[model samples]
Target: MIASVAFRNFKALRETSLILAPFNLVIGPNGSGKTSLIQAMVQLRALARLPLRELMPDDERHPEGAEITFRFQPPFDGLEASLSCVSESLCDFLQVTPLSTGGGVDDWVGLRARLLSLKSYRFNHEAIASTSALKDGGELAPDGVNLAAVLFTLRNTNPNIFECFKAELLRIQPEYDEITLIEQADHTIALGLRLAEGAEVVPSDNLAQGTLYLLAILALAFDPEPPAIVCIEEIDRGIHPRLLREIRDLLYRLSYPASTGDTRPSVQVVATTHSPYLLDLFRDHPEEVVITEKHGRTAHFTRLSDRADLAALLEDGSLGDLWFSGILGGVPDEQ
Candidate 1:
């Protein structure tokens, strides 16, 4: 599990650090650096897993090596590992490389785009990939394409798990009972997601924007060995308020263990949401609610549990109104 993270000049963060918990709420308005934080993690994790040489970097001045650190604890045995790297791909195109060019600045000059992306996560450093995103030196595509590869890998190594997930899909979509991977005569493999509800599985790409959004959310959130620390943007996007608690509970169960006989890894979720209904789901446990906004470029993560009068506001059924009205004291009061 990731104990904490500190980022400097990475995307929207000029310099910020936070103590990470198992289940956190990174609530903030859009563009308040919420996605940037998660993006920073994605890039850092990618670099740690993929060698800097395989990626294409767009910058050369900052050098993608401003230094990133990770303080992490592994699962099951609680093994510890750490990693830090020059922004990957940034130096891949530097003038020194055959396909790269140098910039005016030398110190981290290669990290121009994405603001140097100087960040880190805690993990086993040597496990860092020697050439690509696969933690093991095997060839694999970047994360944008990592999902499918991951499914295939899981299928081959853990057929039981894959079969279980397939059965789950069937249970969730009784009408689309048939799901599998097929390869045409051309040797191109494809996912056949069929829906039996008189509805077609339509492949993930052909899904309605709403369905696509929900599918992506589940895909990322339901991993077997989920990330130690995770941050999600607009937790309620394309999802109905009625499903907020259900999904929240799903995510929560994914993050922490319950009384089940089977053991699973721990996952921490940090999500930003605007739905009061989402907040209301945690009424019994106030600590999960975090409210945030920007003071110019700075992000303020506030705990709503600190407010003594929140119960009354919740009683009035104006959770959203109270939040925006500054009674919860997350965002700045409008003039």
Candidate 2:
């Protein structure tokens, strides 16, 4: 997880940074770097599965422009970050820099991770761990979603850790009437949900996109060893408004302090949402609220914390109502 991120020369962002926290909500216009920022982190994780030199032009485009620097922390989780070599065609018209743009026999790319938390630990380039295949280094695997396979692999080697994580996720996924783990011929396990009428294993793909999205969120909750910051591109993409609060509460529970003598994931979630459902649910976690604005070529954060009228509106105990009250500036499009 990343506590904060600094972007240099990246799309729209020449040099900008934002402080991050668990259960983060990033709201902004279309061109804001919300997804771009999240994609930068995704690039970090994608390194494990693919060689950095393989990154294509399509890899970095979110809405528009270019990005240069990104910084994050628990000082630096030993996770990996991957990127294509700067020497590639993607940088053909690029002016380039001394640290990354210049070419050498060292022209390889892969994940690079920080060992200490950014909040407390200093930066160290050598602090990174990497595969011999790439010059870049860090913990994330290719395609980002491959994290699922990584999780499965880890669970196989660390049953206790896996069980601990699963319990926590199930706790957040309490809405499900029933859940089951099924094994496949390829030796992979899938989580199945039972609706009110019948009981059967429902494939993750078969479930609503929101379900997979929630499951992905729970993946952070299951990190056995939690991250300092976890960034998600879209928080309210495909779920029902009714379920948004459950996800928010789960995030809150995950971020809350562990019980006496009990261990929990120390994860912070940084996500983007258009749904007022999430906004209303997490409006109270002041430190976690963020609004992004896409003005001209740059994207920046806004003040969406619990303000005077907003707080009173939230007291009404209705997310839909609070949204319509203009807290986030308009009623949510429940369409």
Candidate 3:
């Protein structure tokens, strides 16, 4: 997991740093660098795994002299990677340096693998409902376009994990008796839901928007080959407010596997949200919530747990109420 991230000249980030927890919920008004921060992490992942030319078309890249630095916690303590853009043109070239002298080439390789394992998702309702062509199993796409294929692969390869994923969905929406994957004559695949033991399978296209989103998330949480770090944008979208708690628990399950008694390695999760309902869920875990504020041209981040008078502040109202009332810094300024 990343202990902290510092970046300069990256979109609204300008020059800012944020201390992160295993599972983080970033809340703020629009354009306050919430998305920018996640993009910065994604950029770092690209830097670690892809060619510089491949990243040239990225909008998050600064023209020149922009840099990002990461400080990781153990078992990666004292290991840091810094990437600086050294080119003057839009074709920015990155120079990466590992600051840990004690770590060997194997350590660097491990770091690269971890970075390669990072996956950022911004699920689209329509994309999640669309049919997917059959292909070799891979990570869920950023837009979740391949959710069906991914689930299909999981069901075929790892039935245990797939069963867990199905159980999670059923818990969330008990109306579904079973989760199914239908393979069409064209070899394309679509997600199906069985309303009863003997009921006909309903295709994903007929599923509600929120059901698709929930299934996509459960699939990610129970993925056999889960990413080391998962970044999600608008995590609360397309779901009922009542299900936010379940959503929170699933994300926490990714980072806090011990809480569920799962033996799998924990995954670090960072999610962005504008929903105050979701923010309230993290009230007990203030360290896991970061508030973003954009002042002038620079964006700033503050962990809610870092507040000195949090006890007194909670007295005013619930965390969501306080934030919505503008008592919290994440609210928008009326200029």
Report the lDDT tens digits of candidate 3 across residue range 1-335: 78788877766676789888888899988889888778777877877776433334456555555667787766665576666665321113444444545343246567778888899999997998888988834788888898989988898889888888888888889888988888889877878899875687888888888988898888788888789999999999988989999999999889999999988998999999988888888777888899998877677888899888887998768898888998778877688
Which candidate number maximizes lDDT? 3
Worst 10 residues of 1 by lDDT: 122-131
Per-residue lDDT, model 2, residue 328, is: 54
Residue-level lDDT tens digits of model 2 in 1-335: 45455555566555577766655777665666677666655554443333234334666544334443333343333322323334311222211112322222232221133212211111111211111122111233322333345445546666776676566555655555554554456555454566645555565556555665565555554455555545555556566888777667655655663622336646555667677667666654655676665556666655466355656666765654554454554222233
Query: lDDT of each prediction vs. the true structure?
Result: 0.49, 0.49, 0.81
The alpha-carbon lDDT assigned to residue 17 of candidate 2 equals: 70
Clash count, one per candidate: 34, 44, 0
lDDT of 2 at 273: 67
The digit string of per-residue lDDT tens for model 1 on 87-118 reads 53121121212212322223222232222322
- Top candidate when judged by TM-score against the true structure: 3
Superior candidate under TM-score, 1 versus 2 = 1
lDDT of candidate model 1 versus the reference = 0.49
Give residue 233's error in model 3 in angstroms. 0.4
RMSD of each: 11.4, 10.8, 4.0
